[model samples]
Target: MKQIALDIGLTPEPTLAGFLAGRNAEAVQHVRLWAESATRSPVPSYVWGPEGTGKTHLLRAARQALQSQGRVVGWLDTDTPLRTPFDERWDAVLLDDVHRYGPEHQHMAFNWFVNAVSPLHGKPRAVLAAGRLPPADLPVRDDLRTRLGWGHVFELHPLAEGDMRAVLRQSADARGVFLSDEVMGFVLGRFSRDLGSLMQLLDKLDRYALQTQRAITIPLIKSMLENE
Candidate 1:
């Protein structure tokens, strides 16, 4: 059975520790609850949001956490089909962009969800899924739609208003980089404003600043920008 390759551009390291769950705090906590051993297996959970809203990040985070605990976790992305005889050996399964599944696929997925949440083979085999719309708004099969909403459903809210800068400053501070307002503004102005890219730039600048024994000043950032 062939499966579609995962998106090459998805973030490489998406651990629970690394996720910057800003306005998605409550949702984040809900998802992480599945990782605890005593919390019960096959914990069917759903997280929904528009693209680039950390849905992929949180799904991968759960995968990493469960894998560390020695659970067999399966992850299927947007184009990947839910290949059947749906393996019950899996302790956790993460389905991303689930709204894309068509009628037949949805039926297969519905069955998988049913068994996962049921105590058929003891504690349920946990599942975490993400999509571009909430279960109620999803344009998939109604029965499948109802099942999706059965568990703890969370909406992955985008970062809070006006907090990105503070997040950058705090991240920089933690990494021992003095990201000045001027430089942060300049970087924000001149480069990609996405939180992920901005944070990566700040990290690289911190390393460069340490290597050159230079303060994180505008001039230093300017030089770094040139090399970048």
Candidate 2:
């Protein structure tokens, strides 16, 4: 996937809408705190959590919020090249999936991270999102691991059943689709509880409904599920 920089002026209204719709109060609070810290801190912070826990979305939201403040924020996907150096140029850095970077790149990331946090003439703040906490048996340098542990680490908990329903409803509403309670129950009962799977299933259903000109009723959902 291409690394896109978010428009700084964008209000992050869409992200807020999704958070409200999903009733993710904790995430909302975390975003607020991260924005505040990014402005004041010298070192970068890490937001670590399990897979499918909305870490990516929160990171993007933080980027949007920071950019709106006229800060020069850059996003680096650890799976991609870390071409930008941590000099006096950037105000903040957002690194996604930092755990996935290979050995050499991981070292480079670590050095860049230290420089960003260093009390030098031009150091930038940083925010990183990872599937797990750093220094946990991953193939990362020890110094890098220690540096990653320096900042605030917030773990996004898995959504409960009620929260899951809210997330599904929010996702459907965002897509201009109505997913009924019965259909949702059927999906939850039959499919994996992971948010990634649920979102993918919703995408498939949305496309299938559009293509077939059918409402996403329980029967239609069942038929689609059966076919799949």
Candidate 3:
């Protein structure tokens, strides 16, 4: 039988204010400044780190910040089919998961990087990109890789256990639920430790709590896990 799964609970919007900068405080600050700066620099900013290190979070935060400021931004990722080259009307371009781009995506990324840095008309547009590896280590074309390293390059670090705990508690609070120390410890030990995974788990718990009219507890989590 084909089973359907429905998404439940509200996923918090990714924002700079919500980002928990543990070891990557400098990276977070740099992205914030770049997004908020009135003087647009041609030089692009790129962040590289392992999976689940908040690379996408920072990129999305920057996008939201720019859009809130009324800047037209073009966003692309490895999955986007770029049949046409990048347009110049955008005030900025955001590229996410650059390291996962295949050959055609690589071509598009290179073209977009060039156009963003040296547009034929007007000053250059700000370019922000994130990937899983450093520019030099990226498995992409030489030109695209070179452009990725041309400007500010930052490497993100994973959050500590203490920081992760704070994030989980804050998120639970936002969802109007209380996560006790025991539940927190169980979730941390029983599930994937990555922040993204933890957030998804919390969402599931939130939905289960709402559905059963019960507070999130160790027994609730155990039942949820058993059913899964």
Candidate 4:
């Protein structure tokens, strides 16, 4: 059988302003400062946490923030191709999902770490990395693993329920949709609570609302789920 993709609405690009800092406010602030080129140190910034802690979100936000300032940044993750070696002209590098890297990615990441910290002719470039484990506990090569801890390391935590509710409301408002308290309570009670999952649900509801020419309500949500 062929798979049918859900018509989820356009997702708002991840931005520092859109991120709900929750308990990770310091991490967010650090990333903001780093992206602004305010941090003088060449040491990399590392963030680690379980899934749904917004590790990828922070990385992408930093990337956008840096590029907006006319800085060249290279982004790498488990999915991004690693064909070229690290270049000094790039102002920064972002490595996502460091915990899941295989041997090849580990080697490439090690090179990125080394070159980012100690460029030959110019000022050192910043490196930002994220993973499921802290640098000390990462399973990558020992040398790369040690370098991951050379700078700031932050452990992100899941958002609080209040924070989650605020985020849902904020997202709904941004889309010009009214999410009732009833719908919010029902959705939060019924589905996965992770911000990633919740945002996806919001996207689907937004699309369903547009499709059916109706406001998002508990019944509409149920209908969408039932139709699936």
Candidate 5:
């Protein structure tokens, strides 16, 4: 039988403030600043990095920031074909995971990049795109790959171990749970290390603790993991 999974929790917003930028602080600041201003320079940004380096988070945050100011923004991703080209009508555009895009998606994204910087547009527009490889190495058409370098291009680095721990601790505290040092250490050693997945794991642990009426301890976590 096919399993039916229900999404029972509220989806959290991905914002610049919530991200632990770590070594990618410069990239995060640049994207945030560009999104917050409509009259800023017409520099299109391209950010590329490993799969879990918070690329999608930055893209979503940028789009949300622009929309909050009543500026029209366009967002696209690899999961679907483009319905409309991101054009001069938008104050900014955020295109996520370009590496997963086939040829047609690149056509839309490339046009956006070109026109967002065209002198004929007469208005400031920013285009933000992200992929898993740098511009020169991205497996897209040569013309689109070349356009990705027109503005600020950042290659994000993974977070440090210390930053990961702090993220877990902060998230646990915010959830009204005491994340003990020993338990935290156990989690680090036994579970996924990426910050995004780590946060999700902590959320699961918090809910599990509540369900079982137990503190989130190493033994409790071990028991929970064993059932998986």
Candidate 6:
């Protein structure tokens, strides 16, 4: 099989460790449950949700768990060309950012789907991620859209305040910084109610902390946020 190189550029590859460390308990539990079900049936699974809702995190976690079981896994980006060859012996496949793959790419994705689901020698299981529901709802071929929905689907919801706080604290701890509840509340109260934005804020704070060599405190966070 000829491997195609999808132009992912400098985008960071998803990691189970980082995702698990940042994810909330509910999301973790849901992914674990899905993994259990997937092992028994070994059918395609779909996960969708709003941006910053941790859809990618769950997908990556599931991929890692399956890999640890010695299952062969392949990843495809719907937005890009199918750069990676499909391993007939693969136990699973993960397609991320499916919405980004438009009509032209849909042709390739459709072909990949046929190959993946084919009853050949050793076809791999599959999992797909998207920002919306059915593929038809997206700008994809009707056949591809129908094929995408032919599996179990899970939609990850946004994090609650407590969950968000937990994630912030965990991320801070991972960076060897102490974040007081006061600081956490101050940051959350002022920032957008989304993990992505919160994460961006945390990144800035971390950089600031490094530069100043100071602990993450409410005053320091305020100063940083204000400066930005």
* CA lDDT scores, all candidates in order: 0.72, 0.67, 0.86, 0.86, 0.77, 0.66
Candidate 4: misplaced stretches above 4 Å? 1-9, 38-40
lDDT of 2 by residue, 1-228 (tens): 323423342222336336532444665675666675635565556666667666676777677777778787756676555555555566766767766767766766766676666636754566554545444545577777776777666566667888889888888887778988998898889888877677778877777676567889988887776888
Against the true structure, candidate 5 reaches a TM-score of: 0.80
Per-model TM values vs. the true structure: 0.67, 0.76, 0.90, 0.89, 0.80, 0.73
Q: Please write out the lDDT profile of model 1 over residues 161-195, one tens digit for every residue.
A: 35667767766666655777787778777877655
Better of 4 and 5 by lDDT: 4
Pick out the ten consecutive residues of candidate 1 with the lowest summed lDDT: 2-11
List where candidate 6 sits over 4 angstroms from the true fold: 1-30, 33-40, 78-82, 134-136, 222-228
**Best of the two (1, 2) by lDDT:** 1
Kindly report the root-mean-square deviation of model 3 from the true structure over all alpha carbons. Answer: 3.0
Per-residue alpha-carbon lDDT of candidate 5 for residues 1-88, written as tens digits (9 for 90 to 100): 3233234442355667777789998998888777776476767789989866888878887777777788887787777556575555
Report the candidate with higher TM-score, 3 versus 6: 3
Model 6 C-alpha lDDT versus the unseen true structure:
0.66
Question: Which of candidates 2 and 4 is the stronger one according to TM-score?
Answer: 4
Q: Candidate 3 residues 1-228, lDDT tens each?
A: 323334543666677888899999999999989998998687889998888888887998899998899998988897687666688789999999998998888888888888888888788899999999999999999989988999999999888889989989988887779999999998888788887788889988888777677889999998888888
Q: Rank the candidates by TM-score, best first.
A: 3, 4, 5, 2, 6, 1
Clashes of each: 5, 0, 0, 0, 0, 2
Question: How much is 69 displaced in model 2, in angstroms?
Answer: 4.0
Whose TM-score is greatest here? 3
In candidate 6, list every pair of residues with a backbone clash.
Answer: 4-83, 88-122
72 in model 6: Cα distance from truth in Å? 3.6
